[model samples]
Target: MGNLLGSWRFKEPSTVEECDSTWGSDSEDDEPAVEDDSGVSDSVSPERERAAGDSSPQLAEPRDSLPKMKRSFYAARDLYKYRHSYPNYRKSRQPNEYRNLCFYLNKIPLVPDGIYIEEILTKWRGDYDKLEHNHTYIQWLFPLREQGLNFYAHELTQDEIKEFQSTREAKRRFLAAYSIMLDFYGIKLLDKSGNVARASNWQERFQHLNESQHNYLRITRILKSLGELGYEAFKAPLVRLFLEESLCHNTLPNMQHSVLEYFVYTIRLPATRRQLLRYARQHYRPAHAFLWGPPPKRRGGGGAEGSVGAGSSGIRAPAPTPEPQRRAEESSPTASSGIIVSSHDAMMCQELGGEGLKSSAGLGSSMSRLEGALMMAGARGEMNDYSEIVPL
Candidate 1:
């Protein structure tokens, strides 16, 4: 039968003694001793001799005399061997290791020509993806996508890019919010100590704090994180605090002007005003002892005490003094005190004119009869003139 695995022919082999000495036995001892032209033995070690013998044909003269191979096949072999030992080496290698391997491999001409073309293309695509992903991620995190892109493209230094790339989303959001807050407050985030803290993992760190504490920590963390992101941390906190206090209601009397300003600012929001009024109405009480104020009396009829009158000067006449006997008849301190109304309520009254008088009756019926009478007069069209009732 024909040879199945191609033409198989065995030729007579040359004797060991007749074989060319260049391809020597694969043994250290088989290496010939280095000799001068006269065949005198030299003191070179067997390893050195083997290297010298192997290199002789390719490179004339001693290896030490020539430039060391800028790169060596042996080094490449060692790398391949090392990489094989680790399971994950086939995946992405650590940056430094990959760089070294790439540098070494690039110097070797033994690889097929243009072999690196495909590798370079692959790497370029990966880098592009990485940059694109980073761009998209930053845009998702902040409305300042264009700004961030500019910063990364032209403003960011190499170190900054490294930091941004290494930073996680939580950290990035904290930084962005913190920077915006600082801009709001006009404060810097960094301190003289240089012990910058990052907001990246802040939520996890202070998750156990109470609501108030959590808010405080969150603001502070945002500031610190901004610092880590190379912004002014101090300013961010100050701005955030200002905004928070201005918009939020602070019951603390001793709170600073900055904090109060922030609270007031926040209160300006429609939602915030609604909440403030809702809360204030629930807890607020007037200092006056009267359960209800008297109905506003008519300008001319009976000229009852506590009656308000419209005047030419636009000022309303004050309530008349009660007769001594009548005062004695109803002298409860609660009855004597004027009705208390919130600024909001007073504004409503002024806006509604005479209709506001009816509102007073429904305010609370437990008020004194004297106060009720005043409220009824104001309700019954006698004091339709809103010019008399001062807006709170």
Candidate 2:
């Protein structure tokens, strides 16, 4: 009985000095010891053990902090590269307020005397036949009636005037209907007359434009008006419009001609062919490379300049093909073959290198191991090796 009592004796509790030396004075009073019926002692208290876990230094910092630090480091490195590589890069980095000022300045239309007169002439050329033969055309004309009379008269002949009136009236009706359709889609177009308008249910009208003329006039109007907000602001509205219409599903046949004509006729801006290219890249898909897929050759004696009559007439002739071809040939070594290799070429080159080959080999091995594991786990039946798969 004495031997059994000795085995069951409770060990004396350690002194406060011992507890302080082990876990510091702050935890000395907080920690409490425990003993079983047999009186075996445990060095750590329950509270001390929990405190040890809660105060781990490893878990002190947040999980997201490291990733944020890495991202900022990369961004700084990219900005340094951009600043050193490009000469005009700093212009783009101007304060947002300064950029807005430049943007607003460009939006002010250059309404010169000549341009104003041209607008009047354009209006007259279309409306003249609609007026009674003796209906005082001069009185109906806007403020600019006296300048460049011969050109205006020559251009607006009796037959031309009739055609123009027919076209103009048709366009007006179409615009009215189109405005209603835009309203259904929650988009409104402000007319030149200061009236906010919407499009009618113009599914048929849209189909006509798509199949017959390939001219989306309402869309063009939206793009042109929004374009006055400058390039960046213009893109978002255009993209949003396209997404709302689900235009991406259908490939636009004659996209270049349709887009350019929309800009020229509806926008009524003298956009050069180069400007058209820029517009396509900025507004359309970044991957869109084809421009009418082989532009037609300009034929005649004096090339583009002579054909267009380049002396302030404001009419630009179509670009001559030979000159474009010559320029293309000079720019590319394989231009004649119509081969264009962009960044995709660089990736292919890297894949053929030693380091890339080694990495690819490792990937192949890991993939094989994964396949084996999947097969063993009954997730797959069999596997075939794809070690020879090319990068590009």
Candidate 3:
């Protein structure tokens, strides 16, 4: 009974034995394990194998190889370096940076283009010195002339006039300014002796240009100026140019209107007006009636003197038409003579009491009514009667 009890007694193993039991079994189970020659475990873990496989040796080389990428990494990263140092950089390269900047002494703000002379004059209030002193302000003159500011150009100083006459841009401006002054204001560029300056020169220049050149705008302005200043002198030239030149055909309505306006406003002579009407009737019959209100009536004897001085004479005598006989002649004359007299000869013969003579009272009554029509037409701003007086 004592031996049986001793054999059944349980005792714990030593630490070394316990450790060998646990580790030794696991090591034997693991296949192809490495042994450490230095007595330390040389077995690599799964994590260590993965890290060794991923790691690679790198060769040292320059980062930038192209000319464009020559900047260092530190310099590229420092972005604010340029912003702080640009002034110094510009100072070093001053020639290139400052080439475009220009400064002018006594410069004023430029006026807006197409400014009117009236507005400029009103602003300046006729103070010539202010404009004359400033070179920059004087530069505005050319643009002003382009906008048709002739009156202001006419007021140029002697220095300015000399500048204008000599400069290339001044040719047209000088002509336009002087012409406008003479036409509208009856003022000419005069000498100290009060004689017209360059009068013959202007005439010769304009007349020669009319024959040689075809600058339509300059020619038109010249013609208008001369017509307003001296109609009798320009009349023949204007008529010839209007009839012969291509300006009338190419610039249709504007040209026609300008020609008609000249005749309406400038020409005051009776014979001149008659000749204009006849020419217009022969050439442009469509606009003839609109331009010249009514044709002259058939005149009896002793009417030549009246016709000649009709423009000077304020009151015009109306010629009575024998419409009853004239209309009868169109169909067939019922008179025993069976012969037709021209309207003019008939009127003369009737006034002489040869035949078809109306009573003086009847003729006077007809004349009174005709005179009222003429007066009303003139008052209403309608086309003037062809035979009406043209006031000088």
Give the winner by lDDT. Answer: 3
Q: Which ten residues in a row have the lowest lDDT in candidate 3?
A: 98-107
**Per-residue lDDT of candidate 3, residues 1-392 (tens digit):** 88986456323222212212111322323223443222112344565432322221210111121011011112111111111211122112232221101101112223433444333434643233443233332223222111122222222222333343355443444234334333221124343222232333444333433433222223333433333222234443344344322233432333443343232223323334344533443344222112232212235444422221111111222333468856767677465467666657644643332111113212111122211121222212212222221111
> TM-scores across all candidates?
0.16, 0.21, 0.23
Better of 2 and 3 by TM-score: 3
Candidate 2, superposed: residue stretches over 4 Å from native: 1-189, 193-200, 214-256, 261-277, 283-392
Best by TM-score: 3
Candidate 1 vs 2: which has more TM-score: 2
lDDT of each: 0.27, 0.28, 0.29
Model 2, position 332, has a per-residue lDDT of 88
**lDDT digits (tens) for residues 243-322 of candidate 1:** 33333333221232222112222211222222332222222222011111122333443332222111111112222334
Q: State the lDDT of candidate 2 residue by residue for 57-124, as single tens digits.
A: 43234322211100112212222221122112212222332311221223221122222222332343
